[model samples]
Target: MAYVLQSDQRGIRTLTLDRPEQRNALSDALVTEVDAALEGAGADPDVRAVQLTHTGTTFCAGADLRNPPDPHALVALMRRIVALDKPVVARVTGHVRAGGLGLLASCDISAGGPGSTFALTEARIGVAPAVISLPLLPRLDRAAAARYFLTGEKFGPEEAARIGLLTLAGEDVDTALAPVLDGLRRGSPQGLAESKRLVTATVLAAFDRDGDDLVERSARLFASADAREGMTAFLERRDAAWVW
Candidate 1:
């Protein structure tokens, strides 16, 4: 089954996450599909904007824990999103967690419904949000990142917006996203490409400088005994042995 559905309308290309049964988890296959789609959109002259959304109630549940993705591939996917020349807008109407938060942060603009929730959940699995931190740390407020990264607490869209994780939060995410997409569609392709470069320069630089180390860190943690036990316990629907 296809993990991502792609369609183009006007000047916008929309890539809908289609793995609702998995809550749109970022499995290796899904990440590879998304990367290919983004690359295709970036290279298409007719595509002026990209809209990212999901089919399920949960936007993305992060990596599929049962078949955890390759950390290097995850890093490459995030880098592709950040480096895509066209403006990428995330229309979020569902929950985002762990690596999903990294996906959201990489977009140029992200609009989410008021009920949408978010969290950096890796800590609960005894692994840090290492690869994701490349994009997320730059986008999130330092203090907010510290709190959520440490606690793995769920928060609503308002706090997500306030902390710079989202560009807009409203009762209706698509409604809020329309004007932003329209604005993106109106810009000349060159103008939008250059402007996005100006905005994402720092993020790209961070990826260049630290992406390898972060990927290594993530791989090491996932290989650790604690992370394996925590992930296993999570899948088994029980507290990890270390949890007291």
Candidate 2:
């Protein structure tokens, strides 16, 4: 079964995450599919931009604990979104958590509806939001990042925009995204690519410099005794042992 559904209209390629039953979690297969779709959009001359959206109420529930992708592969995917010559925009109107925020941060622009809620949940699961911080820390408000990354508290779309996790938030995601999509469609191929580079340079630099270290850190954390207990507690619908 296809994990990603792809279509193109008016020079914009749309990639929809299709694992609704899984809350569109980032399984290895889904990550690979998304990466390959992005590659196709990047190479197609007629594709002026990419719009990444998803089906279901949870845009992504972070990594699939049962079948998480390699940390290196996840990092590479985030970097690819940042470095893709064409602009990438995320249209979200659902819950996003943990590593899913990393995906949102990597995009050039992201718009979410009022229904959207976000959280950096890794800390609650006995791991730091390490690899994701490559794209997240570069763009998020420092104080905001510290607060959410450590506390794992959920916030609304408005707060997500205020903290730089979302470019815009509105009552309707498509309404907010229409103008941005129009802008992309109007931009010349060279114009969009060059302009995107100017905005994403810092993010790409973070990926290049810290990517390897973060991947190792993430792998170590996931393998730790604490993470094992936390994940086990999560799967069992209970608080982790550390929670009082």
Candidate 3:
């Protein structure tokens, strides 16, 4: 079966992640399929917006270790998401964790069900959430988001939406998604394209100017004695000391 299922409705192409048994883990082929779908949506003149959703209860559980995701591939996918020609909305139904949460953050609009959960879970698995941080950082309340990043706890949707991780959170996902799509319909396609380009360019410009600074910031954490301790504790099934 195809890993990705796509359909276009009212100029909005919604891509459904089809791997319910694995909670939609991004295996190599899954990522490739997703990227290809995104590319197709971008090229189709009839597709003015896209919605990324999953078939099962969870939006995604992140990448599976059995078919670990390559950093390069993930970077390319996210870059495309951020640079897509049209607006993309992430329709999350249940838990969205780790790198999957990164996908939510990169999209232009995000709508999810009530009581859904979210987490930056890499800290619990002896890894880092660096992949999603670029897109997530801007959306979070600096001090509050730090708590989850350091401790890796699953937080309530209320808190997630309150802290800006979720743009819409109430009722079933479809309820919220309907209005977002309706609103997008009134927007000028050319205007959306120009606006998206300007916004993406602004963010990219800042990152480009601070490329060295980002490297420095990341290097410091990787070299930190505390980060090593945290990863080791996670791997050893011990409690992390930095719980916030």
Task: State which candidate has the highest lDDT.
Answer: 2
Model 3 lDDT vs. the true structure?
0.78
For model 3, the stretches where C-alpha displacement exceeds 4 angstroms are 206-244
lDDT of 1 by residue, 1-244 (tens): 7899999989999999999999999998999999999999999999999999999798999999867678888888888989998989999999999999998888899999976999898889899999999999888899999999999999999999999999999998888988888898789998998999999999999999998998888889999999989898889989989887
Q: How does residue 106 of candidate 3 score in lDDT?
A: 80
Per-residue accuracy of model 2 over 56-89 as CA lDDT, tens digit each: 9989999999999999999999999999999999
The per-residue C-alpha lDDT of model 2 at residue 227 equals 97
Show model 2 residue runs off by greater than 4 Å: none
lDDT of each: 0.91, 0.93, 0.78
TM-score-sorted candidate list, best first? 2, 1, 3
Error of 2 at 241 (Å): 0.6
Number of the candidate with higher TM-score, 1 or 2: 2
Model 1 pairs whose backbones collide:
none
Top TM-score model: 2
Q: lDDT per residue, candidate 3, 28-139, as tens digits?
A: 8888899999999999988879999998877888776567566557666777888887998988877887878877888888877874788787766555777567677777
Better of 1 and 3 by lDDT: 1
